[model samples]
Target chain A: MNRAHSKTKRTAFVVAAGLAAVTALAACSSSSGNGGGGGDSGPVTISYGVWDDTQGKVMQQIADKFHESNPNITVKVQITPWDQYWTKLKTAATGGAAPDVFWMNESNFATYASGGVLANLSDKLKGSDIDMSNYIDIQTKAYTFDGKVYGIPKDIDSIGLWYNKALFKAAGVAEPTADWTWADMVAAAKKLTDPSKGQYGIVAQSAPQQSYYSTIPQTGGQVISDDKKSSGYDTPEAIKGVQVWVDLVNKDKVSPSLQQMTDTDADTWFTSGKAAMIFEGSWAAAEFKEIPYAAQNANVAPMPKLDQPGGVSNGLGNVMSAKSAHPDAAWKFLQYLGSKEAETAQADAGIVIPAYKGTADGWVKAFPEFNLQVFVDALKNSSQYPSSMNSAAWQDPIELEFNKAWSGDETAAQAAANSAKIMNDALAAEK
Target chain B: MTSQLVPPVEQGQRRPTPLPPRGTKRRSLRHGDRYWAYLLILPTAVGLTVFSIWPAIQTFYFSFTKWGTFGGHEWTGLDNYAQVFHDPELLRSLWNTVIFSVMTLLGIPLSIGLAALLNTKGLRGVGVYRALYFLPVVTMPAAIALVWKLIYNGDTGILNQFLAVFGVDGPHWLSDPATAIYAVGVVSIWSSLGYNMVLFLAGMQSIPGEFYEAASIDGAGPWRQFFRITMPLLTPTTFFVTVITVINALQAFDLVYLMVGKASPAIEESQTVVYLFYAKGILQGDGGYAAAIAFVLLALILLITAFQFRVQKRWVHYE
Candidate 1:
């Protein structure tokens, strides 16, 4: 027993020693943020950070292409999961150790730009062949702060109606067309629903972008005022937009219950043949095309309109860090990332719609089986995804209130009014 | 204990009287030895001061401020704490945490029973049974979460399929707000079984076999022997396990965060205190509010520990 005790102690010591060595080695490797400036005559490695793992492969290809042009500069593509990307980036920026170039979302770019964490790219826009008019107006305008461009637009996204052709055929319902209206969607959903067979026409998730964001404007409502000072949830149009799904899930029985949707998301519901229809973004096309069921049965259409053809468009931008050691090298990579060459690579991958104008056709052609062009067309009348200085602060409250409405715990009108109060307070606190 | 003494020999000699007037030079060889020990501990001391102590101080200071974007902050007095006090969700989460701790404490008795069964005399394949029970504790949380998610899924989960044998349909375990916290609690108990049972087994084995033999000769049945002898003897282990389990359960986040997920409808009820802090601090970029939540948890733990110490006197028998 004594010998065994000593043996255990010895083993524990060895393990501790091993862990310390590994930690030291890891720290040494991760502290390599030196290669940012273009002054390095020899080989220099710059970090290019991205969030989506799917799009990272194409970004890596872009890096390779750029390397071919300027062999002295090396771009290392780093992919962090989207959920943790901003949090990790915030910590890195605080430590003065952010990536040389990183992906930025419009909702968050303002906060970082205001904090002086993003580099001003006005000079780059002026000097380079990258024309301001080449990209979508809202996207370019989304990344601008203090009338200066802080980031170059990467990809533009718009919501679309994804429906299963096989399900529609079996139900004897016509597939959704470009001219489908809100009433047409509800009618088709009712006809297609077969609840006794454990199938629903759609899965109405507690999702903002897919459901409320698109439908709100179509019903003629704004999520926030033009000055971004107050909430629009209290408006009759907004309440109608939110009530559309509540009525579908609870009253019409054409959609799954809120609990079921929470257990398995709408995307999974649509993919598994349980749901005939779902509202999804263009970014989902790549994933859906990969799934055999969706690949064969699923196709896209523009989000159904009510009074006018309207949807919500959001985009990602590529920005250089303000504290980058190699600012010139970082800027060069940023230029290449936003160029037609990089956009073509992204389009050919069919993962996302490049924000670059006239390059969306390649994305549509990449997935010829699906009607991917509906997303591009939807962008023509889409509004910017509603954002403020700190979006998550209010987004969380709105979602929480909306969940109650979705769960039938509160009336849509009541939930909308309560959400507006919370949103207004958050907006007031932002300044 | 040693006494400080005046030299009585100084009275016998006048020359010694001058030396007695001054302080005595008492020699302790162990003191010099500890100097070398302090040197040995210097590295650890420095590491703790830099990593642990500094962060604790910062968390306290930041609790009094509002975190601005990009790591900047401004002094905000007690506004964060005021918000924390007024935030209904924070209160709800605290209540949820308390419920989780109490539910998980139920595992203590269940584990003790399993430990006794494993410790049965002449039991065959004891090692195998121990390993089987211990597997969940060793498994990765993410993998365990996925497996449990599949089992708890309402549509096609094996649990509901089993319930269908009785012509019953189980609720959506991880998604339904009514059952999500309890579902997570069940997983928590299953995971904690090994650690608690090991402690109980160690406590049981240390008990003298003669006590059981004596009890048997006095016409005590096996059940009586367990209740009278084993229970009292295992008190210390029970006390230790109880305190540790309470602390561990109060800080519960991983299972709830993984199983219920952020998008689940049950998140409102299923969120543990740490999960709330994570959302506010890490996800929402509100570090000051997060710091305040951390301190509230810290204060709660201190109070519970004090109460446990007071209650422990009634049960734990050190001898």
Candidate 2:
């Protein structure tokens, strides 16, 4: 009787515990639902996602500013680092829980826009005061798909030649100038290279955007056709562009070996005083400012010309999730983020060159040590950063094939031909 | 349901109380008890189904489908599998995984030797030595990979500096295709040695002291005792360690991802199957192909584990 009574009590206790757990779970979900399903008039909070930690602070300030004018709506800033940002965004979008607003890059913009996860802003812009002309042309165009704009231009970046003045002075080589051509740069690189001191003239990284993307166009070649239907790597101009970098490593021996560069990135080499020159983007200006050695000696110059002044330019855009519960709030915040006041604040932060045309002056002045104007000026002659609906598929394989050329195992032409075939196949498969 | 619950309790009670629980009231009590047992297990069972079994089923289903960039997927039958079979990159990664597994497995003997040394009688500061060896096991893999990357740097690395002291020029350990995988494998072995040694120590301590005393009395030296008694007794632990090491090595991704990186010239040679899966699925948005790669890895791991289990009977001694 005692044992039976005890078992009966235990059973009742267990049943009660299970019910409590279920109730707790139910309460949690219901509260979250309430938070997400805020009515049109009630207080609502929307999230804005970005990648860079340096820029995330400025974003928070902008969010605070947006909240001030609209007291009923709150804005939250969320930052995910660059490496995990895309993967997290994809997973969240799949689960219908992506942030209300987030930063978008050109390379991944097509995939996201085509996926229909991004909110179409074209319809919203028709009734709003925001002008598309207010943003950089390339940025606005990059985010447009199927005659609809999906993102607001946030910031723009362009490639430039970053040289260490101290290294040039020590080697008795002339400083890279605006009128410098590819031949002049190469000659100076030869003079700057000193094997005895274990210093290289430059780092010929295999980075597409910073190196070959610019060089390819400079040599009068295209990466992908403007129509995004075919690859131009098989063209003789493309081969010459690749050969320019390859020869620096294997022929002229002016740059660090491909193996050495692979061990340490070009940015590290330049900052550590191991290399004299590196082709870097404007986004690097803030980072270089933080490095004492780079801040003291590094300065930017126009990218050395080949056929013509050439570089690749790209930009970031702010996008809203299609499924955002607070769509009205998100759009308001997005508009505020693209406003001149917010852009001027961003420029003042010195983290990025705001896509708002006149706001970039503050960014240029923020870093007085380096010639930040070169990046803004390069924007005029630079081609758009090449991307397709599925760029990474072709880009990854092309880099692998190019690594062989970089390592001196294959000629540049052979690698370029192989890359062309692979790229074309990938492009064909995209449809 | 009441009848099923009553019988088990009745059987258990029959042995204890001998026909004391024959009434409907007792039967109802037993039924309630069964419900209680189920309720207690309900949370764990739900968790397992949701997190493990359900995902496995979904992944198996996804393996047959082509996924769009967003959420949706369409059935494609065996197309992704066929692509996986033909991919040269997949083949290379598979080969790299095998080489890495073999290299890590080679550390087991070294682990056993260290465990035996630490288990030696009258050893002082055994706790300190054991703690020192176990440090890497607790350290994050990312931290270890980053530190090792700096050490293996070609021009300005501590490893090269140490080598230079001996009048030897070291190859670029991580950048060169010929040396990258082996360099990573060395770090893998070093990091896992502490974990394997601890397991061996536990196995060694469990072996009867009487057996060793008997061996000594039978005119056996230390080496003889080790060969005859310790080696045979250690077989079970060794088998367990080898199986786990192989599984871990085959799943190697984090260290390679951090150390070799996507831009490295050595990446082509050093990347494992899991890394390739990540590159294809997560980085490249080829979910269907990545799922197919994952299933292949699963199949490979199952086959290798089964082979190890089959081979273990020849050497593993339970006694």
Candidate 3:
């Protein structure tokens, strides 16, 4: 009787303990930030959100200038890495508690702009000395939607061939020139590849957007038609452009396998000297410069042209949010950013190739150890990434199949055909 | 007896005894005692409403409306639900989630094995072993995933290097689609093993020693004792663990999201249901569709839980 009573007590104790354990787990998972808003209208508590790790200084300086002009305004710079920035911003936006101003990108700008999340800056910049026309045409167009400008153009980044000077000498190859054609690039990559040493000729992270998207224009293919209803998915030129990277992996054996690339990010691989060359945007210049080896050996050159020239050498532009509460202040901040003063500061920081025409001259002077001039000349032939309604939805499926094609799961022709259908279906659905 | 009957019967009776009723004082005392019991439960009841119940109701309402940027609601009934049904990506994610849950379920038997081992008498360092095993459970998820990611690296990871000794090449565990889900599921299982083991250990410890002592006296082997006595008695703990584990697996998000992000080539094969909802609600700003997906998830969880409860009647040994 005593043993039976103890057993019953033990069972009840275990049940109660388990119940308590489960409840504690639920409480820990659900508890989050208190719904506390920051102080209301004190010192102009502007939270400037940005994604780039290297450009924080340039951004800080811009904020400092804003503070100088309006002594009452206290700007705080918040840096969210590129990957987490968009997701966090969206969460904050839905909560009606987003940062006062956050950096925007072309891919996400249209969605946010149309969703009534951004503050319209058109009227604020109307009679100001900002002179929006002074910025690049494509840069302004990327942020303008429904005849309203939602973002101020901060900077521009176009792709360029960043080569290792040491690798060129080792391969007994001459430095790439202003007029180097596609044939020249392939030959140089072939010479530089050395598998025994765990080195590859080029590091491309196996993305159509990163490696093949811009190259499509070189092969005389448009990414999106004028109507934006049809895509350039199945065009022979586009397929040919994509095959260049695939051949690099399969035929030339100069690029890492899809699995190898997946294991190691392309930027890290290039900076570590595992790959002698890479197609990189000006945005990476800061990161590249920080790598000890790259600082000593790397130099930028314009992207190789086709045999007859005239391919699209396009790039991405930075945008700002439209639903920003501080429209006047944000616009004023953007105007200062667009000014030669801000562009020069950015160049000196080795942050990016300024979109303003003359600003890159200072970039070359500031970073005299590297050849930054090549970036300036490269922009002449550059085109912007396609901006059509539903591009994000369309690109989602297309990019997935393209990756499969590169990994040998599907042939290039089959992948392209399938993606074209997916793209077309998405576009049709949008209509 | 008089205290229980007098209060109710007196209302119908024309007249009570002129003397003080025998049960009146006891009945009033009982009422006061029950009121205090309710007061004791008040804090917990209020907390549940403010936290759990309110959020659940709000999530359901949010599903039927499109959220404005500045935080107002505009209802668009069934539009979000329609979109969720048509989304191939969401469907693929659900399939992946089921696969992950099954893979994680394999950890249950493994935990039982550990529990049985730890339950052994005269085992030295059992406390130390249990604490070491539970290390992953207490560590932050991001830290755990990162360490696992390095170990799973194809070129320089310790796992691949160790495989080289056996004349085998380890596949890219985190990057290869064929093995990525299993690889992540392995981490999930590893991290959760210790917590589950402790529960099992506690349950095994609770079983009366006399049953095992009697079985041994009757010449039963260890396996026989486990099957006949220990297994039967540990059923309640097993039921609770299984329900919690399945629910946890269905809601899997952090490991997949952090280790294999959307831009990853392998993401197509790795995304779970919550990851899909995150993409729609947070990434793509389709809150309505995201909310619809959430409701689908809630329905799935409810149905599965109910099914588990129904099945428990056949197998669960309460005694």
Candidate 4:
């Protein structure tokens, strides 16, 4: 009995020893528990968070330029992938330790803005050298709420029909023009498809910004109502828009199945030369130009015309945390980020379309090989990326059922109706 | 769980007595060793109370309220729980987790078989064999899942390519609702086999060699010695492995997150309760719903563990 007792006691002591080491390490953290993010006025290394790694070089250049002028403040660029960025930011903001400055998008803007986590930049911009008039109206409106601006436009993104000229030439199909209609696109896709090569003519992606979002609007349906109180997914026009992709995938067999797209994404299929065409964002130009085949043969044209001509217009903004200790330094950094010089740098990299007016020339010339002007031309007739407060509440639920339509388990109308019901509940919850 | 690292004292022919009840009339630690013991344990107790127990209380409180953004919430008694009960997706995920736990239990016996084979007398090159089996346990699960995803790919994977030689067509394993859950279960079994085998090997090594020799001398063959001696003696280790494996399978998320991502068509069939909690809490920003899901999972695990403890009295033999 005494032996077993000694054994238990010995085990306890060993565990206690291990835990002691952990506690000592925990105590070694230099800062106390209650210190906030960027809570020092001394030489500070402010974390500048972004989602896209393709623009990491340009971001570093921007940071270097800022360091040269400020000399005391330093910025470190932290890249979190797009899929995890919002959730990570949400957790940090809820814990009251959000990064000083980070990228923001319209899809996730209202949640943070209305939650009082974002710093109001209206006062900061009032006396700043950055001209608000130089920025696009749509992007400025996206970053504003109740007469308070919480974000400064970083870059704009618009979708275009990126196609392979070599494939079109090989298939004896003419290259698509800016005024091409939906029928012309279908015919070209049919002509370009080569089943023996294990290749499809087009990849009909389910991506909101690149595919159905633009197509729905072109078919004379708004994703969100003007009052932002209702979803138009239940409308016949919206059903027709969704049906376009379904037909391309299941009926015509010109596009890969939904399952295939899930395995290897549309972007990969296009860049790998397995798909002749794709609806891609302007930001992908930098990534595609890195690939040899795509760099040589890929070119862009405006999204084809249907009942109406449009594409999804989305832009990213730089937002400051309301809880930042160095709000003045953060504002100065944000102002510099929105300056014409920073936009020019972003333009020369061809990573993204700059939101500042008259700065798209360098972006267009960055890739002298391709017709990059298509993205800028599409923006003229573009619609805003649809979003309301708590957009994810409905967006997630809708996608849960929407995939069934793409997989041919349900008709487009049924999916749209189900989507509308769930979307309405989410929209109602936002109020 | 206490570690098996320490050598257990062999008390002859007497079962272990349960520790005396606290506050009993005995020479309690209150007299002398209590202070040192308290000092030794102070750090762990404080860490648990602050990090674990405190957050549990907060999560419980949040379960009763609907959260907006940035810690904003309003009291809505039992509303979130009501939503959870009515949610079909939650129920489906719970069922999948149950199936996942039971399916993963298949690894326990497989590991025992490997452990016994390696325990063979004068086994040739057993160390190389053991290292090969333990590789999966040491590798990162994300990297494992990524490679498995390519192998399971429908159109161009090596798995389908291999199956083609036999004139067999393989379904899209990770994308098909009928196959995705089973595929995930198979991977779970593969990944956990090494860990369970190590535990059983430790247990086997602790057994005295004379016990097996005596059984063999009584005209018992190798299979008889295994069933009569090794199996009965290994009950305690088996119990621990079972409990740990059950808990791990029930809390599975990493493999599901990596293998069948959110875009997969088979998510409804393959997602676990924890994935639902993540989607609702972090992705959808519904903290109340997520808290409720977590409490439900806790209740389930608690009941299952209690039932296991009860069932162990029938089979688990204590020295």
Candidate 5:
């Protein structure tokens, strides 16, 4: 009888233990849930998400500045690394827990804006002191969809020719100039290449933004029509553009083989002094400045022209989630992010060229050694970065098809034709 | 007489113990124990239902639906499944998966041999040797792949440099389409060898030492005994190891993703089913198609594992 009594007591204890564990779990979750709720009467904290760890600190500073003006609203900066940024954002947005404000890029702008997840800023802008005209036209245009602005312009980037002056001097070749043409650049590449020393004159990477994107337009080709309904890859002009890069590696032997470039990226080759020149973006200035070898030797020139000056320009914009718990607070922070003071701070940091028209002068003057003006000037002739509703679907396949041409396994025309067929199919599917 | 005496004493002891607890009390005690057992199991049961079974059901349902980039999805029937069957990239990835599975299986024999060597009698510092071989097993796979990527680099890699010493120029190991999958397979084998070897060693040790002793008495040589006894006895372990290795190889993604990357020419030739699923589903936001690919892979694994179990009956001896 005593044993049965003890057994019942032990059983009761076990049940109680389990209940305790479950209660603790429930308590933890409820506490976290309460933390997310910010009543209209109380101070609200909104999160701003960005990629790029190097610029995260400056973002925090901007957030702090925003908080100083709007004492009732606190801004929290969240940094997700570039590789995982989109994947996290997609999952979070799907779960209705995305950051209140986040950085949006041109390639992905349409995907997010059309999904109805982004807050419509048109009405808000009309009531606020923020003028859309203060930002670059291309950026503002890129962020607008169906006659409504979804994002505020943040920064602009354009490609330029980054040359190693010391390598050119050693090869007895003249440094690249603003007026240089495609033929002149090719001739210099031949003189700069030294096979015995394992040095390449230039790196013609398969990257669209740095290499083929600029070249295709320079050769009078378009990646997509203005309506974004079709691909222009099969055009003779596009084929000619692809052929130029292929010929550099296969015929001229002035650029490293595609295999070599794949093993060591173009940026590494330039920074290591193994390549005389590379086509790079304005965003690379801060990274180059930190690399002593590259900073001492590298300078920028306008991208050499084919039919006309050619480059690709892309911009980032700040967007807010439509489902934000505190929309008013998020809008105030978003406006502050696009303000002249914020733009000047971004420009002074020299990490990027602010989208505000006159604010870029600070960025240009930040690095006096290099010709930062070339990046800003290239924007004038540059085409907007090509994108469609489902750009990623076609972009990957296009890169793979182009890689065959880069590897010399297929002719430039054949690869371009194949890319067009696939791109067209992807575009059709998008509808 | 002793058996008769023992039975009555045991009965006496058992009878009195039960007699003290009346039928009602005993029944109540059993009910109490039953409730306690359920409480003990609740946490694990809840966890498995929520994390594993729930997601699996969701994925199965999602395979028949098309998803928009952000949130909403539409019921698309077998459209995603139909596309999966027709995809050329899926076909290529399946072929790569097969080649990779076969290549990594080569490690099984290598592991068995190493395990035998380590199990030799009077081996000095066996612990140290085992730890040295097991280092890769404990290391993170991403770290291993990154280190191997550096070693497989075309120009400045230690591997190419070593090959240069022998006056034989090496092809680019990772960037070259012809060699990338094989290079990644080699790393997979190297990392998994320690794990497989440990299992084999345990299996070897479990075989009674008396078998070898008795074999020696019967005039059986070391090689003869190993082939006739150890190999046959190790069949069950070998079966388990083979099934696991094949499943893992078919699911190969992390090493390929980290080492070869999307931009490499080798990616097309080296991508596995999981890699394609990641690209289509996550990166490109084609969740429905990715779910379909996952189901296809799951079906393949189930078919292969069922086949392994069926085949093992002929060779695996429990006794």
Candidate 6:
């Protein structure tokens, strides 16, 4: 009887333990915590998140300067890399644990603004001494949604043809002229490539933003329609433009294959003198400056044209986060960043071309040996990277298919069609 | 149910003081045994509840909601699940996963062959060979991916560079879609080979030497002995390894993610189901849909595991 009773008691205990485990498991979904809302007057410690460690240093300097002016506001800088920045920001934003301020990318601005996460800074800008008119109009509009200014333009970067003067001299070719056409570049590339000696002409990349779209206007093609609906990739001009990139590998053999470029990053190839020419953004100038060969041999020129009757250029700019807690401090910081003062500071860094109206003069003086004048000229007409709703959702799928097309696994037409369908569905889903 | 059927048996031989009254004494002893058993399992149970089960439940709940912009979520019913059917990306990823899973299956026989070689009783310096074989398993997957990428480099890779001496130009191992999946799968097999071999070795060691000796005395060959005795008896371990390998292959993301990041030209050919989940959930901010995908993945695994158990009787001979 005693043993039987003990067994029953043990069974009951086992049942109780199983019940507790299930109960605990069921309770896992509930979350607890209060959001750190900004107080009206107390010591406001705002967290600012930005990508680019190089820019982060400049931001910190600006914050330090702001601290000198406004002692009450303390800003904390959070530096997340480009790959993880937007993802981490969105996750943290949804959880209400986001940094008080964050950097905004043109690609991600629409998604965040549409979701009502950003604060309306239109009234703040209009009422304050921070003049929005001081910056370029296109850049100011890139961060605006529904007629409300959600972000302040910080800086601008445009793509330019970076060439090695030594490579040019070695190949018995003249330096890249400002008025060079696409034909001239091809001829230059052929002259530069000496495959027998392990040097290539250029790095042919299928990247839509930096290289492809930069050449689109040259071929009289726009990446997306102005209304931002329907496919721009299937057009004749765009296809012709894209072919220029692909032909360097497939036809001309002047550039390394797509696989080679992907394996060894194009920039690494350029910096190492393995490639003579590369289409890199002004943002890369500082990195180039660090490479010994780049310091002595590299110089910038505006992108070559397609021999079209009339064509121009454009570029993208940096924008500040709208959901910042320290709005006043952010405005002040952005004002300083856009001032000729910050432009001189950034230009001295030798990595970026300052976006302020008269900032190019400072950069020209800073890098006198290099043709920094080309970047300044390019700024007069460079086109912006197209932006639209569901760009991330649309572009990623298209790029995935495009990679297949590049690999010859899928034809360009087939990939384009598939990409269009995918983009359409993704855009429709957002509705 | 098993606990209820099997009555607890405690022998009184070790204890000298035994004489308390029936009802109260039995209850106290039962409580004491229950307390100790609970104490023994407390840590593991707590850990599972805290880590696995809780998160699983949360994932399920999160699946059925629309996320708010700046925190919290509103219930969105089965919309997230409905969206899954419409997601072409998910379909492509699932197809890719199937191909990868089938490719990784080749690792099993390869591991068995390796285990068989190392299990040879008189093999000299077997320990060093085993260590070398097991290196990939212990090394970080990221490091393995990076090193393998360099080795597979089209131009300057050591593999291709070596091939050039023999007048053989190696194909772009990772960049070519036709070869990319196979190349990645090869790395996956290499990484898991050591772990699977170790498990097989442990199972092989547990088998008595007398069986082999007895078979030898009967004039039986190694092949005959392996087929008739060794193979049948190794069923349980084989089942465990197969189940684990299948689950691991299903969840293969890290190697693919580390090797071919989002910007890689080979991403289309190399993406796995979990990689798709990560891209959509974390990268794209579609958490609800991602949660739905997760649950679907979980259900698929459970169904497959159940199917495996159902069919085990056919091939898994229990000695």
RMSD after CA superposition, every candidate: 8.0, 7.6, 7.3, 5.8, 9.2, 6.7
Over 4 Å off, model 5: A1-35, B1-30
Fnat, model by model in order, equals 0.32, 0.37, 0.25, 0.27, 0.38, 0.24
Positional deviation of residue B98's Cα in model 4 after best superposition, in angstroms: 1.4
Off by over 4 Å in 6: A1-43, A307-340, A361-369, A408-431, B1-29, B32-51, B61-91, B219-229
Interface RMSD of each: 12.7, 12.3, 10.3, 8.5, 14.5, 9.0
Better of 1 and 3 by lDDT: 1
Q: TM-score of A-chain in each prediction? A: 0.90, 0.91, 0.86, 0.90, 0.91, 0.85
lDDT of 6 by residue, B39-84 (tens): 9989987986676556666777888997654456889999999988
The digit string of per-residue lDDT tens for model 3 on A165-216 reads: 8888888989888788877888888888887888888886665556777687
The lowest-lDDT stretch of 10 consecutive residues in candidate 4 chain A is A25-34
- Residue-wise C-alpha lDDT for candidate 6, range A105-166, written one tens digit per residue: 67777777887767677776765656677666666777788788877666667778899888
Clashes of 4: 0
Q: What TM-score, over all chains together, does every model reach?
A: 0.91, 0.91, 0.85, 0.90, 0.91, 0.84
- Candidate 1 chain A worst ten-residue window by lDDT: A23-32
Candidate 2 lDDT by residue in tens digits, B1-319: 1231244446555654443454643433477887998899899879755554445545657779988877789999999999998999999999999999999999999999999999999999999999999999999998999899999999889999999999999989999999999999999999999999999999999999999999889999999998899989999899878877877787888889999988788888999988888788778877777767776876676567667766776998878
| Model 2 per-residue lDDT tens digits across residues A215-267 | 99988999999999999999999999899999999999989987888777779
Where model 4 places Cα greater than 4 Å from the true spot, the runs are: A1-45, B1-32
DockQ of each: 0.19, 0.25, 0.18, 0.27, 0.22, 0.22
Best by lDDT: 5
- Comparing 3 and 6 on lDDT, the stronger one: 3
Model 5 chain A scores worst on lDDT over the 10 consecutive residues at A25-34
> How far does residue B165 in candidate 1 sit from its true spot (Å)?
2.0
RMSD from true fold, candidate 1: 8.0
lDDT of 1 by residue, A1-431 (tens): 24333344333333333222222212211212333454666778889999888788888989999999999899999999987777678778877888999998877878888889899989767768678778999898888887899999999999989999999999899999888887899999998888688889888777899888888888899899987888999999999988887898888888988888877778999999999999998988889988999999999888777776677888999999998888878888888888888987888877789999989988999999898878888888988888888887888768878888888889999999999998999899887
